[model samples]
Target: MRSSRARALEATINRLLAGGPKFFVKDHRAVSASGDPLRYPARTQRLDYEAEVAVVIGKGGRDIKSDDFTSHVWGYTLFNDWSVRDNVSFGPDFAYSKNFDTSATIGPWIVVNEGIDPQDIPIECRVNGELRQSGNTHSMVHSFAALGEHLSRDTTLWPGDLIASGTPKGTAVDSSRQETDGSFPDTLFVKPGDVVEVSSTLIGTIRNEVVKPTG
Candidate 1:
Protein backbone atom coordinates (compact mmCIF):
# COMPACT_ATOMS: atom_id res chain seq x y z
CA MET A 1 0.00 0.00 0.00
CA ARG A 2 1.14 3.61 -0.52
CA SER A 3 0.70 4.23 3.23
CA SER A 4 4.30 3.22 3.95
CA ARG A 5 7.60 5.05 3.52
CA ALA A 6 9.36 6.01 0.30
CA ARG A 7 11.30 2.76 -0.01
CA ALA A 8 8.22 0.61 0.49
CA LEU A 9 5.97 2.89 -1.54
CA GLU A 10 8.32 2.89 -4.50
CA ALA A 11 8.44 -0.89 -4.52
CA THR A 12 4.64 -1.21 -4.48
CA ILE A 13 4.13 1.42 -7.18
CA ASN A 14 6.75 -0.26 -9.32
CA ARG A 15 5.39 -3.74 -8.65
CA LEU A 16 2.73 -3.01 -11.20
CA LEU A 17 3.68 -1.18 -14.35
CA ALA A 18 0.32 0.56 -14.13
CA GLY A 19 1.20 1.95 -10.67
CA GLY A 20 -1.84 0.52 -8.89
CA PRO A 21 -2.03 -0.20 -5.20
CA LYS A 22 -0.55 -3.53 -4.13
CA PHE A 23 -2.78 -6.23 -2.77
CA PHE A 24 -2.17 -9.57 -1.08
CA VAL A 25 -4.17 -12.44 0.32
CA LYS A 26 -4.32 -12.90 4.07
CA ASP A 27 -4.98 -16.10 6.01
CA HIS A 28 -8.62 -16.43 6.90
CA ARG A 29 -7.74 -18.74 9.78
CA ALA A 30 -5.59 -16.06 11.39
CA VAL A 31 -8.62 -13.94 12.30
CA SER A 32 -9.47 -14.07 15.99
CA ALA A 33 -11.20 -12.26 18.84
CA SER A 34 -10.23 -8.66 19.53
CA GLY A 35 -9.02 -9.55 23.02
CA ASP A 36 -7.55 -12.93 22.09
CA PRO A 37 -3.91 -13.76 22.67
CA LEU A 38 -1.53 -13.13 19.78
CA ARG A 39 0.08 -16.55 19.75
CA TYR A 40 3.74 -16.01 19.07
CA PRO A 41 4.66 -17.89 15.94
CA ALA A 42 7.35 -20.44 16.66
CA ARG A 43 9.55 -19.34 13.77
CA THR A 44 8.71 -15.68 13.45
CA GLN A 45 11.70 -13.36 13.69
CA ARG A 46 9.87 -10.03 13.46
CA LEU A 47 6.33 -10.08 14.75
CA ASP A 48 4.64 -6.75 14.03
CA TYR A 49 1.26 -5.10 14.39
CA GLU A 50 -0.23 -3.12 11.49
CA ALA A 51 -3.01 -0.73 12.47
CA GLU A 52 -5.65 -0.48 9.73
CA VAL A 53 -9.25 0.43 8.97
CA ALA A 54 -11.48 -2.34 7.61
CA VAL A 55 -14.73 -1.54 5.84
CA VAL A 56 -17.48 -4.11 6.10
CA ILE A 57 -19.22 -5.18 2.89
CA GLY A 58 -22.97 -5.07 3.11
CA LYS A 59 -23.88 -5.48 -0.53
CA GLY A 60 -22.43 -8.08 -2.87
CA GLY A 61 -21.57 -7.67 -6.51
CA ARG A 62 -19.06 -8.55 -9.22
CA ASP A 63 -16.93 -6.04 -11.06
CA ILE A 64 -18.28 -3.30 -8.81
CA LYS A 65 -17.87 0.14 -10.31
CA SER A 66 -15.72 2.67 -8.50
CA ASP A 67 -18.54 5.14 -7.94
CA ASP A 68 -20.74 2.35 -6.57
CA PHE A 69 -18.29 1.18 -3.90
CA THR A 70 -20.19 2.93 -1.15
CA SER A 71 -23.46 1.09 -1.77
CA HIS A 72 -21.66 -2.17 -0.98
CA VAL A 73 -20.36 -0.85 2.33
CA TRP A 74 -22.33 -1.80 5.38
CA GLY A 75 -20.14 -0.23 8.10
CA TYR A 76 -16.57 0.30 9.29
CA THR A 77 -14.32 -1.17 11.99
CA LEU A 78 -10.71 -1.65 13.14
CA PHE A 79 -8.30 -4.38 12.12
CA ASN A 80 -4.78 -5.28 13.07
CA ASP A 81 -3.00 -6.93 10.14
CA TRP A 82 -0.39 -8.64 12.30
CA SER A 83 2.57 -9.54 10.12
CA VAL A 84 5.70 -11.66 10.42
CA ARG A 85 8.74 -9.82 9.05
CA ASP A 86 10.75 -12.83 7.96
CA ASN A 87 10.91 -13.75 4.28
CA VAL A 88 8.86 -10.73 3.26
CA SER A 89 9.33 -11.52 -0.41
CA PHE A 90 6.30 -13.23 -1.88
CA GLY A 91 6.95 -16.95 -2.29
CA PRO A 92 6.43 -20.22 -0.48
CA ASP A 93 7.70 -18.82 2.83
CA PHE A 94 5.29 -15.90 2.60
CA ALA A 95 2.37 -18.20 3.33
CA TYR A 96 3.72 -19.67 6.57
CA SER A 97 5.07 -16.38 7.82
CA LYS A 98 1.75 -14.50 7.63
CA ASN A 99 -0.73 -17.37 7.78
CA PHE A 100 0.07 -18.38 11.35
CA ASP A 101 -2.72 -18.69 13.90
CA THR A 102 -3.94 -15.57 15.69
CA SER A 103 -1.99 -13.39 13.31
CA ALA A 104 -4.89 -10.93 12.76
CA THR A 105 -7.49 -9.17 14.90
CA ILE A 106 -10.84 -7.74 13.70
CA GLY A 107 -12.49 -5.44 16.21
CA PRO A 108 -14.34 -4.83 19.47
CA TRP A 109 -17.28 -3.53 17.44
CA ILE A 110 -18.42 -1.92 14.20
CA VAL A 111 -19.57 1.67 13.55
CA VAL A 112 -22.09 1.98 10.73
CA ASN A 113 -21.11 4.24 7.85
CA GLU A 114 -23.71 6.98 8.02
CA GLY A 115 -21.88 10.23 8.72
CA ILE A 116 -18.43 8.70 9.08
CA ASP A 117 -15.82 9.77 6.57
CA PRO A 118 -13.94 6.55 5.86
CA GLN A 119 -11.31 8.40 3.90
CA ASP A 120 -9.98 10.48 6.79
CA ILE A 121 -10.09 8.56 10.06
CA PRO A 122 -7.29 8.56 12.61
CA ILE A 123 -5.55 5.29 13.44
CA GLU A 124 -2.95 4.28 16.00
CA CYS A 125 -1.08 1.31 17.36
CA ARG A 126 0.44 0.85 20.79
CA VAL A 127 2.81 -1.71 22.21
CA ASN A 128 2.70 -2.03 25.95
CA GLY A 129 0.91 1.36 26.04
CA GLU A 130 3.63 3.11 24.06
CA LEU A 131 2.63 4.71 20.77
CA ARG A 132 4.16 2.89 17.83
CA GLN A 133 2.04 3.75 14.78
CA SER A 134 0.11 7.01 14.25
CA GLY A 135 -1.53 7.91 10.97
CA ASN A 136 -4.77 8.61 9.14
CA THR A 137 -6.55 7.12 6.12
CA HIS A 138 -5.95 10.28 4.12
CA SER A 139 -2.41 9.12 3.29
CA MET A 140 -3.58 5.99 1.53
CA VAL A 141 -2.33 5.80 -2.04
CA HIS A 142 -5.61 4.21 -3.07
CA SER A 143 -9.05 5.04 -1.74
CA PHE A 144 -11.49 2.43 -0.40
CA ALA A 145 -13.64 2.86 -3.48
CA ALA A 146 -10.72 2.29 -5.79
CA LEU A 147 -9.74 -0.80 -3.84
CA GLY A 148 -13.24 -2.16 -4.12
CA GLU A 149 -13.27 -1.41 -7.81
CA HIS A 150 -9.97 -3.15 -8.46
CA LEU A 151 -10.53 -6.02 -6.06
CA SER A 152 -13.86 -6.73 -7.70
CA ARG A 153 -12.55 -6.40 -11.21
CA ASP A 154 -13.56 -9.99 -11.90
CA THR A 155 -14.39 -11.35 -8.47
CA THR A 156 -17.58 -11.45 -6.46
CA LEU A 157 -17.90 -9.50 -3.22
CA TRP A 158 -20.26 -10.88 -0.62
CA PRO A 159 -21.90 -9.46 2.43
CA GLY A 160 -19.81 -9.55 5.63
CA ASP A 161 -16.62 -9.73 3.59
CA LEU A 162 -14.36 -7.21 5.28
CA ILE A 163 -12.02 -5.16 3.13
CA ALA A 164 -8.98 -4.19 5.20
CA SER A 165 -7.86 -1.23 3.04
CA GLY A 166 -4.26 -0.69 4.15
CA THR A 167 -2.08 0.34 7.07
CA PRO A 168 -0.67 3.75 8.00
CA LYS A 169 2.96 4.87 7.98
CA GLY A 170 4.32 3.96 11.42
CA THR A 171 4.81 0.22 11.83
CA ALA A 172 7.67 -1.94 13.08
CA VAL A 173 8.70 -2.13 9.45
CA ASP A 174 8.92 1.64 9.09
CA SER A 175 12.47 2.92 8.71
CA SER A 176 11.61 6.29 10.29
CA ARG A 177 11.37 4.72 13.74
CA GLN A 178 14.50 5.70 15.76
CA GLU A 179 14.06 3.01 18.37
CA THR A 180 17.00 1.25 20.07
CA ASP A 181 20.14 2.16 18.17
CA GLY A 182 18.17 1.83 14.91
CA SER A 183 17.42 -1.86 14.46
CA PHE A 184 14.65 -4.46 14.37
CA PRO A 185 16.41 -7.17 16.38
CA ASP A 186 14.03 -6.95 19.33
CA THR A 187 13.25 -3.28 19.80
CA LEU A 188 10.50 -2.59 17.29
CA PHE A 189 9.08 -6.08 17.08
CA VAL A 190 6.58 -7.26 19.64
CA LYS A 191 7.48 -10.15 21.93
CA PRO A 192 5.78 -12.38 24.43
CA GLY A 193 3.92 -10.45 27.18
CA ASP A 194 3.65 -7.33 25.05
CA VAL A 195 0.18 -5.89 24.96
CA VAL A 196 -0.57 -4.71 21.42
CA GLU A 197 -3.52 -2.41 21.04
CA VAL A 198 -4.90 -0.98 17.77
CA SER A 199 -7.56 1.64 18.23
CA SER A 200 -9.66 4.36 16.55
CA THR A 201 -12.43 6.57 17.78
CA LEU A 202 -14.58 5.63 14.80
CA ILE A 203 -14.80 2.07 16.02
CA GLY A 204 -13.03 0.84 19.16
CA THR A 205 -9.86 -0.80 20.46
CA ILE A 206 -8.73 -4.33 19.77
CA ARG A 207 -6.22 -5.28 22.44
CA ASN A 208 -4.30 -8.52 22.17
CA GLU A 209 -1.51 -9.71 24.44
CA VAL A 210 1.43 -11.45 22.86
CA VAL A 211 2.02 -14.83 24.47
CA LYS A 212 4.28 -17.84 23.97
CA PRO A 213 2.59 -20.97 22.77
CA THR A 214 2.16 -23.76 25.32
CA GLY A 215 1.97 -26.62 22.88
Candidate 2:
Protein backbone atom coordinates (compact mmCIF):
# COMPACT_ATOMS: atom_id res chain seq x y z
CA MET A 1 0.00 0.00 0.00
CA ARG A 2 3.06 2.22 0.18
CA SER A 3 3.92 4.56 -2.65
CA SER A 4 6.87 3.93 -4.90
CA ARG A 5 9.17 6.95 -5.04
CA ALA A 6 10.44 5.83 -8.43
CA ARG A 7 6.93 6.11 -9.77
CA ALA A 8 6.43 9.45 -8.09
CA LEU A 9 9.60 10.97 -9.54
CA GLU A 10 8.62 9.74 -12.97
CA ALA A 11 5.15 11.28 -12.72
CA THR A 12 6.63 14.62 -11.70
CA ILE A 13 8.93 14.67 -14.71
CA ASN A 14 6.14 13.80 -17.11
CA ARG A 15 3.89 16.46 -15.62
CA LEU A 16 6.51 19.11 -16.39
CA LEU A 17 6.81 18.18 -20.06
CA ALA A 18 4.82 20.07 -22.70
CA GLY A 19 3.66 17.26 -24.95
CA GLY A 20 2.09 14.11 -23.71
CA PRO A 21 5.35 12.21 -23.34
CA LYS A 22 5.29 8.63 -24.49
CA PHE A 23 8.41 7.37 -22.82
CA PHE A 24 9.54 6.35 -19.34
CA VAL A 25 12.69 8.12 -18.15
CA LYS A 26 15.64 5.84 -17.62
CA ASP A 27 18.33 6.66 -15.07
CA HIS A 28 21.28 4.99 -16.77
CA ARG A 29 21.64 2.63 -19.72
CA ALA A 30 25.30 1.85 -20.17
CA VAL A 31 28.12 0.37 -18.12
CA SER A 32 30.64 2.37 -20.04
CA ALA A 33 28.77 5.67 -20.15
CA SER A 34 30.77 8.58 -21.51
CA GLY A 35 30.18 12.22 -22.44
CA ASP A 36 27.72 13.02 -19.67
CA PRO A 37 25.33 10.08 -19.69
CA LEU A 38 23.62 11.39 -16.54
CA ARG A 39 24.82 10.46 -13.08
CA TYR A 40 23.20 10.18 -9.63
CA PRO A 41 23.60 12.71 -6.81
CA ALA A 42 26.78 12.76 -4.72
CA ARG A 43 27.50 10.92 -1.43
CA THR A 44 27.66 7.33 -2.55
CA GLN A 45 30.16 4.50 -2.46
CA ARG A 46 30.17 0.92 -3.68
CA LEU A 47 27.91 1.50 -6.63
CA ASP A 48 26.70 -1.94 -7.66
CA TYR A 49 25.20 -2.42 -11.09
CA GLU A 50 22.52 -4.87 -12.15
CA ALA A 51 21.25 -5.99 -15.57
CA GLU A 52 17.52 -6.31 -15.97
CA VAL A 53 14.60 -5.91 -18.35
CA ALA A 54 12.61 -2.97 -17.09
CA VAL A 55 8.88 -3.34 -17.55
CA VAL A 56 7.07 -0.19 -18.62
CA ILE A 57 3.39 0.02 -17.96
CA GLY A 58 1.29 1.03 -20.92
CA LYS A 59 -2.08 1.11 -19.24
CA GLY A 60 -2.80 2.39 -15.75
CA GLY A 61 -4.92 0.69 -13.12
CA ARG A 62 -5.52 0.13 -9.40
CA ASP A 63 -6.12 -3.19 -7.65
CA ILE A 64 -5.60 -4.96 -10.95
CA LYS A 65 -6.67 -8.55 -10.99
CA SER A 66 -4.12 -11.27 -11.49
CA ASP A 67 -5.95 -12.67 -14.48
CA ASP A 68 -5.93 -9.31 -16.25
CA PHE A 69 -2.27 -8.42 -15.79
CA THR A 70 -1.47 -8.71 -19.49
CA SER A 71 -3.87 -5.90 -20.30
CA HIS A 72 -1.98 -3.46 -18.08
CA VAL A 73 1.53 -4.22 -19.26
CA TRP A 74 2.95 -2.16 -22.10
CA GLY A 75 6.55 -2.88 -23.02
CA TYR A 76 9.92 -3.88 -21.67
CA THR A 77 13.50 -2.64 -21.90
CA LEU A 78 16.91 -3.04 -20.27
CA PHE A 79 17.74 -1.50 -16.84
CA ASN A 80 20.70 -1.22 -14.54
CA ASP A 81 19.75 -0.80 -10.83
CA TRP A 82 22.84 1.17 -9.74
CA SER A 83 23.07 0.57 -6.02
CA VAL A 84 24.92 2.93 -3.73
CA ARG A 85 25.05 -0.05 -1.40
CA ASP A 86 26.75 1.77 1.42
CA ASN A 87 24.34 4.68 1.61
CA VAL A 88 21.27 2.54 1.13
CA SER A 89 22.34 0.58 4.17
CA PHE A 90 22.66 3.73 6.23
CA GLY A 91 19.70 5.73 4.98
CA PRO A 92 16.16 6.00 6.33
CA ASP A 93 14.47 5.73 2.99
CA PHE A 94 15.70 3.91 -0.09
CA ALA A 95 14.59 6.95 -2.06
CA TYR A 96 17.60 9.02 -1.00
CA SER A 97 19.96 6.14 -1.61
CA LYS A 98 18.35 4.23 -4.48
CA ASN A 99 16.28 6.79 -6.34
CA PHE A 100 18.96 9.41 -6.88
CA ASP A 101 19.53 11.39 -10.08
CA THR A 102 20.42 8.54 -12.42
CA SER A 103 20.33 5.52 -10.16
CA ALA A 104 17.84 3.67 -12.35
CA THR A 105 19.09 3.24 -15.92
CA ILE A 106 16.74 1.70 -18.45
CA GLY A 107 16.49 0.68 -22.04
CA PRO A 108 18.18 0.57 -25.40
CA TRP A 109 14.66 -0.04 -26.84
CA ILE A 110 11.16 -0.99 -25.81
CA VAL A 111 9.88 -4.46 -26.64
CA VAL A 112 6.14 -4.79 -26.47
CA ASN A 113 5.19 -7.29 -23.79
CA GLU A 114 2.22 -8.40 -25.90
CA GLY A 115 4.63 -9.96 -28.38
CA ILE A 116 7.29 -11.24 -26.01
CA ASP A 117 7.13 -13.82 -23.23
CA PRO A 118 8.68 -12.36 -20.07
CA GLN A 119 9.44 -15.68 -18.46
CA ASP A 120 12.03 -16.90 -20.91
CA ILE A 121 14.43 -13.99 -21.19
CA PRO A 122 18.12 -14.58 -20.54
CA ILE A 123 19.62 -12.06 -18.09
CA GLU A 124 23.19 -11.66 -16.99
CA CYS A 125 25.57 -9.27 -15.26
CA ARG A 126 29.26 -8.79 -15.77
CA VAL A 127 31.86 -6.69 -14.00
CA ASN A 128 34.81 -5.41 -16.01
CA GLY A 129 33.67 -7.58 -18.93
CA GLU A 130 33.74 -10.77 -16.89
CA LEU A 131 30.60 -12.80 -16.35
CA ARG A 132 29.49 -12.76 -12.72
CA GLN A 133 25.77 -13.50 -12.74
CA SER A 134 23.42 -15.33 -15.10
CA GLY A 135 19.87 -16.60 -14.85
CA ASN A 136 16.59 -17.02 -16.65
CA THR A 137 13.46 -15.03 -15.92
CA HIS A 138 11.76 -18.24 -14.88
CA SER A 139 13.99 -18.30 -11.83
CA MET A 140 12.12 -15.43 -10.22
CA VAL A 141 10.14 -16.33 -7.15
CA HIS A 142 7.65 -13.63 -8.01
CA SER A 143 6.36 -13.61 -11.55
CA PHE A 144 5.38 -10.43 -13.38
CA ALA A 145 1.72 -11.29 -12.95
CA ALA A 146 2.17 -11.81 -9.23
CA LEU A 147 4.12 -8.62 -8.78
CA GLY A 148 1.60 -6.50 -10.64
CA GLU A 149 -1.27 -7.88 -8.62
CA HIS A 150 0.59 -7.53 -5.36
CA LEU A 151 1.67 -3.96 -6.04
CA SER A 152 -1.84 -2.93 -7.02
CA ARG A 153 -3.38 -4.45 -3.94
CA ASP A 154 -4.01 -1.04 -2.42
CA THR A 155 -2.21 1.38 -4.70
CA THR A 156 -2.50 2.76 -8.21
CA LEU A 157 -0.14 2.07 -11.08
CA TRP A 158 0.31 4.46 -13.97
CA PRO A 159 1.42 4.33 -17.54
CA GLY A 160 5.17 4.67 -18.18
CA ASP A 161 5.67 3.10 -14.77
CA LEU A 162 8.61 0.79 -14.05
CA ILE A 163 8.79 -2.56 -12.25
CA ALA A 164 12.22 -4.11 -12.09
CA SER A 165 12.05 -7.90 -11.89
CA GLY A 166 14.45 -8.25 -8.97
CA THR A 167 17.95 -9.45 -9.84
CA PRO A 168 18.94 -13.10 -9.86
CA LYS A 169 20.45 -15.05 -6.97
CA GLY A 170 23.99 -14.04 -7.83
CA THR A 171 23.56 -10.28 -7.83
CA ALA A 172 24.00 -9.08 -4.26
CA VAL A 173 27.33 -8.26 -2.61
CA ASP A 174 27.77 -11.73 -1.25
CA SER A 175 26.96 -13.15 -4.65
CA SER A 176 29.77 -15.56 -4.23
CA ARG A 177 30.59 -17.13 -0.93
CA GLN A 178 33.68 -18.88 0.36
CA GLU A 179 36.19 -17.05 -1.83
CA THR A 180 38.79 -17.65 0.80
CA ASP A 181 42.48 -18.41 0.97
CA GLY A 182 43.36 -18.57 4.62
CA SER A 183 44.18 -15.20 6.32
CA PHE A 184 43.18 -13.02 3.37
CA PRO A 185 39.88 -13.48 1.62
CA ASP A 186 39.94 -12.68 -2.09
CA THR A 187 36.78 -10.75 -2.91
CA LEU A 188 35.42 -8.81 -5.85
CA PHE A 189 33.46 -5.59 -5.61
CA VAL A 190 32.72 -2.75 -8.02
CA LYS A 191 35.07 0.18 -7.50
CA PRO A 192 35.29 3.59 -9.14
CA GLY A 193 36.17 3.58 -12.85
CA ASP A 194 35.31 -0.11 -13.17
CA VAL A 195 33.12 -0.99 -16.12
CA VAL A 196 30.00 -2.88 -15.00
CA GLU A 197 27.87 -4.50 -17.68
CA VAL A 198 24.46 -6.13 -17.47
CA SER A 199 22.76 -7.79 -20.44
CA SER A 200 19.65 -9.64 -21.38
CA THR A 201 19.56 -11.76 -24.53
CA LEU A 202 16.27 -10.04 -25.29
CA ILE A 203 17.62 -6.49 -24.84
CA GLY A 204 21.38 -6.57 -25.33
CA THR A 205 23.47 -4.72 -22.69
CA ILE A 206 23.21 -1.73 -20.36
CA ARG A 207 26.60 -0.50 -19.27
CA ASN A 208 28.02 2.09 -16.80
CA GLU A 209 31.19 3.24 -15.14
CA VAL A 210 31.78 3.19 -11.37
CA VAL A 211 33.12 6.64 -10.56
CA LYS A 212 34.55 7.40 -7.15
CA PRO A 213 32.91 10.23 -5.24
CA THR A 214 34.66 13.59 -5.38
CA GLY A 215 34.39 15.98 -2.46
Candidate 3:
Protein backbone atom coordinates (compact mmCIF):
# COMPACT_ATOMS: atom_id res chain seq x y z
CA MET A 1 0.00 0.00 0.00
CA ARG A 2 1.06 3.57 -0.58
CA SER A 3 2.02 5.77 2.37
CA SER A 4 -1.02 7.92 1.61
CA ARG A 5 -3.39 4.97 2.09
CA ALA A 6 -1.71 3.97 5.36
CA ARG A 7 -1.96 7.54 6.53
CA ALA A 8 -5.67 7.51 5.71
CA LEU A 9 -6.25 4.39 7.83
CA GLU A 10 -4.10 5.69 10.68
CA ALA A 11 -5.89 9.00 10.57
CA THR A 12 -9.22 7.22 10.94
CA ILE A 13 -7.96 5.31 13.96
CA ASN A 14 -6.65 8.47 15.59
CA ARG A 15 -9.93 10.17 14.95
CA LEU A 16 -11.81 7.29 16.53
CA LEU A 17 -9.54 7.36 19.59
CA ALA A 18 -9.94 11.11 20.08
CA GLY A 19 -6.32 11.32 21.25
CA GLY A 20 -6.37 7.90 22.88
CA PRO A 21 -4.38 4.77 21.96
CA LYS A 22 -4.64 3.36 18.45
CA PHE A 23 -7.14 0.56 17.85
CA PHE A 24 -7.88 -1.65 14.86
CA VAL A 25 -11.43 -3.03 14.94
CA LYS A 26 -14.46 -0.82 14.36
CA ASP A 27 -17.75 -0.67 16.22
CA HIS A 28 -20.37 -2.86 14.49
CA ARG A 29 -22.83 0.02 14.62
CA ALA A 30 -21.08 1.49 11.63
CA VAL A 31 -22.35 -1.16 9.25
CA SER A 32 -25.09 -0.44 6.70
CA ALA A 33 -26.23 -1.94 3.37
CA SER A 34 -26.82 -1.59 -0.37
CA GLY A 35 -29.78 0.39 -1.79
CA ASP A 36 -29.79 2.35 1.48
CA PRO A 37 -29.38 6.07 1.21
CA LEU A 38 -26.31 7.67 2.89
CA ARG A 39 -27.44 10.68 4.85
CA TYR A 40 -25.15 13.66 4.51
CA PRO A 41 -24.57 15.50 7.75
CA ALA A 42 -24.89 19.28 7.66
CA ARG A 43 -21.53 19.76 9.40
CA THR A 44 -19.27 18.27 6.76
CA GLN A 45 -18.46 19.35 3.21
CA ARG A 46 -16.96 16.10 1.98
CA LEU A 47 -18.38 12.62 1.84
CA ASP A 48 -16.16 10.02 0.16
CA TYR A 49 -16.77 6.44 -0.92
CA GLU A 50 -14.30 3.66 -0.14
CA ALA A 51 -14.60 0.35 -1.97
CA GLU A 52 -13.57 -2.55 0.26
CA VAL A 53 -13.93 -6.30 0.57
CA ALA A 54 -15.59 -7.30 3.86
CA VAL A 55 -14.88 -10.56 5.68
CA VAL A 56 -17.81 -11.88 7.67
CA ILE A 57 -16.81 -14.02 10.62
CA GLY A 58 -18.80 -17.24 10.69
CA LYS A 59 -16.94 -18.97 13.48
CA GLY A 60 -15.88 -17.22 16.68
CA GLY A 61 -12.38 -17.47 18.03
CA ARG A 62 -9.61 -15.76 19.98
CA ASP A 63 -5.98 -15.44 18.93
CA ILE A 64 -6.83 -17.07 15.61
CA LYS A 65 -3.90 -18.11 13.48
CA SER A 66 -3.59 -16.94 9.87
CA ASP A 67 -3.48 -20.53 8.68
CA ASP A 68 -6.85 -21.12 10.32
CA PHE A 69 -8.52 -18.05 8.83
CA THR A 70 -10.32 -19.95 6.08
CA SER A 71 -11.70 -22.48 8.55
CA HIS A 72 -13.10 -19.72 10.75
CA VAL A 73 -14.48 -17.63 7.86
CA TRP A 74 -18.14 -17.39 7.02
CA GLY A 75 -17.90 -15.58 3.65
CA TYR A 76 -17.22 -12.28 1.84
CA THR A 77 -19.14 -9.18 0.75
CA LEU A 78 -18.62 -5.73 -0.75
CA PHE A 79 -18.30 -2.78 1.65
CA ASN A 80 -18.22 0.96 1.32
CA ASP A 81 -16.47 2.75 4.16
CA TRP A 82 -17.96 6.18 3.64
CA SER A 83 -16.04 9.09 5.13
CA VAL A 84 -16.54 12.73 6.11
CA ARG A 85 -13.35 14.27 4.82
CA ASP A 86 -13.99 17.67 6.31
CA ASN A 87 -14.02 16.14 9.76
CA VAL A 88 -10.51 14.74 9.28
CA SER A 89 -7.18 16.52 9.60
CA PHE A 90 -3.94 15.83 11.50
CA GLY A 91 -6.08 14.52 14.34
CA PRO A 92 -9.65 13.49 13.51
CA ASP A 93 -12.77 12.69 15.48
CA PHE A 94 -13.38 9.38 13.76
CA ALA A 95 -15.94 8.22 16.29
CA TYR A 96 -18.13 11.20 15.50
CA SER A 97 -17.22 11.54 11.85
CA LYS A 98 -17.44 7.88 10.90
CA ASN A 99 -19.89 6.35 13.36
CA PHE A 100 -22.86 8.31 12.09
CA ASP A 101 -25.82 6.23 10.94
CA THR A 102 -25.41 4.60 7.48
CA SER A 103 -21.72 5.44 7.32
CA ALA A 104 -20.57 1.90 6.53
CA THR A 105 -22.48 0.09 3.79
CA ILE A 106 -22.11 -3.64 3.13
CA GLY A 107 -23.80 -6.32 1.11
CA PRO A 108 -25.42 -7.43 -2.06
CA TRP A 109 -24.89 -10.59 0.08
CA ILE A 110 -22.07 -12.80 1.28
CA VAL A 111 -20.16 -15.38 -0.76
CA VAL A 112 -19.04 -18.42 1.20
CA ASN A 113 -15.37 -19.37 0.96
CA GLU A 114 -15.83 -22.61 -0.94
CA GLY A 115 -13.07 -22.57 -3.57
CA ILE A 116 -12.77 -18.80 -3.82
CA ASP A 117 -9.48 -16.96 -3.36
CA PRO A 118 -9.98 -13.63 -1.60
CA GLN A 119 -6.51 -12.44 -2.47
CA ASP A 120 -7.08 -11.80 -6.17
CA ILE A 121 -10.35 -10.09 -6.96
CA PRO A 122 -11.31 -6.96 -8.89
CA ILE A 123 -12.85 -4.06 -6.95
CA GLU A 124 -14.45 -0.89 -8.24
CA CYS A 125 -16.52 2.14 -7.24
CA ARG A 126 -18.81 4.31 -9.34
CA VAL A 127 -20.83 7.46 -8.81
CA ASN A 128 -24.00 7.73 -10.87
CA GLY A 129 -22.63 5.11 -13.28
CA GLU A 130 -19.31 6.84 -13.79
CA LEU A 131 -16.16 5.06 -12.71
CA ARG A 132 -14.25 6.84 -9.97
CA GLN A 133 -11.98 4.22 -8.44
CA SER A 134 -10.46 0.96 -9.63
CA GLY A 135 -8.07 -1.50 -7.99
CA ASN A 136 -7.58 -5.10 -6.95
CA THR A 137 -7.49 -7.14 -3.73
CA HIS A 138 -3.98 -8.23 -4.64
CA SER A 139 -2.86 -4.61 -4.15
CA MET A 140 -3.94 -4.54 -0.53
CA VAL A 141 -1.17 -3.82 1.92
CA HIS A 142 -2.48 -6.39 4.38
CA SER A 143 -4.18 -9.65 3.54
CA PHE A 144 -7.59 -10.57 4.96
CA ALA A 145 -6.20 -13.41 7.06
CA ALA A 146 -3.55 -11.12 8.51
CA LEU A 147 -6.21 -8.63 9.53
CA GLY A 148 -8.29 -11.33 11.25
CA GLU A 149 -5.29 -12.67 13.16
CA HIS A 150 -4.27 -9.18 14.21
CA LEU A 151 -7.77 -8.21 15.38
CA SER A 152 -8.30 -11.44 17.31
CA ARG A 153 -5.08 -11.06 19.28
CA ASP A 154 -6.76 -9.26 22.18
CA THR A 155 -10.45 -9.38 21.34
CA THR A 156 -12.62 -12.35 20.54
CA LEU A 157 -14.23 -12.31 17.12
CA TRP A 158 -17.86 -13.40 17.20
CA PRO A 159 -19.92 -14.94 14.46
CA GLY A 160 -21.43 -12.22 12.19
CA ASP A 161 -18.67 -9.73 12.99
CA LEU A 162 -17.40 -8.02 9.84
CA ILE A 163 -13.80 -7.13 9.11
CA ALA A 164 -13.52 -4.65 6.24
CA SER A 165 -10.23 -4.87 4.43
CA GLY A 166 -8.70 -1.50 3.53
CA THR A 167 -9.58 0.13 0.19
CA PRO A 168 -7.34 0.69 -2.79
CA LYS A 169 -6.19 3.85 -4.55
CA GLY A 170 -8.51 6.07 -6.67
CA THR A 171 -10.80 7.37 -3.94
CA ALA A 172 -12.42 10.81 -4.09
CA VAL A 173 -9.15 12.26 -2.83
CA ASP A 174 -7.65 11.38 -6.19
CA SER A 175 -10.20 13.53 -7.98
CA SER A 176 -7.65 16.25 -8.49
CA ARG A 177 -5.65 13.93 -10.70
CA GLN A 178 -8.46 13.55 -13.16
CA GLU A 179 -8.02 14.74 -16.70
CA THR A 180 -7.85 18.55 -16.99
CA ASP A 181 -9.28 18.68 -20.49
CA GLY A 182 -12.62 19.84 -18.98
CA SER A 183 -14.32 16.83 -20.45
CA PHE A 184 -15.52 15.88 -17.02
CA PRO A 185 -15.45 17.66 -13.68
CA ASP A 186 -13.51 16.20 -10.76
CA THR A 187 -15.45 14.14 -8.23
CA LEU A 188 -14.38 15.45 -4.85
CA PHE A 189 -17.24 14.37 -2.60
CA VAL A 190 -20.59 12.67 -2.75
CA LYS A 191 -23.66 14.86 -2.45
CA PRO A 192 -27.38 14.40 -2.07
CA GLY A 193 -28.99 12.49 -4.99
CA ASP A 194 -25.71 10.97 -6.09
CA VAL A 195 -25.87 7.20 -6.36
CA VAL A 196 -22.75 5.28 -5.48
CA GLU A 197 -22.13 1.67 -6.35
CA VAL A 198 -19.32 -0.61 -5.22
CA SER A 199 -18.78 -3.89 -7.03
CA SER A 200 -16.53 -6.91 -6.93
CA THR A 201 -16.34 -9.72 -9.48
CA LEU A 202 -16.86 -12.35 -6.79
CA ILE A 203 -19.07 -10.79 -4.14
CA GLY A 204 -21.39 -8.75 -6.42
CA THR A 205 -22.54 -5.11 -6.17
CA ILE A 206 -23.72 -2.86 -3.36
CA ARG A 207 -25.44 0.40 -4.33
CA ASN A 208 -26.45 3.38 -2.21
CA GLU A 209 -27.79 6.83 -2.88
CA VAL A 210 -26.63 9.94 -1.03
CA VAL A 211 -29.39 11.94 0.62
CA LYS A 212 -29.84 14.93 2.91
CA PRO A 213 -29.96 14.12 6.62
CA THR A 214 -33.47 13.48 7.80
CA GLY A 215 -32.55 14.41 11.33
CA RMSD, predictions in order: 4.0, 11.2, 6.0
TM-score per candidate, in order?
0.87, 0.71, 0.81
Model 1, span 1-215: residue lDDT tens: 34445676687656643656567777777888788999999887788889999999999999998898988999998989888886576666665666789876998888884588879888999999999888888877788998899899889998988888678766777643534664445577888999999999777899999999999
Stretches off by above 4 angstroms in model 2 are: 1-42, 87-95, 176-187, 213-215
The lDDT for every candidate, in the order shown, is: 0.82, 0.64, 0.78
What 10-residue stretch in candidate 1 is worst by lDDT?
175-184
Off by over 4 Å in 1: 1-18, 176-184
User: Residue 199 error for model 3, in Å?
Assistant: 0.5
- Top candidate (TM-score): 1
Scored against the true structure, residue 32 in model 2 reaches a CA lDDT of 25
Candidate 3: regions farther than 4 A off: 1-25, 90-92, 177-187
Q: lDDT of model 2 at residue 161? A: 79
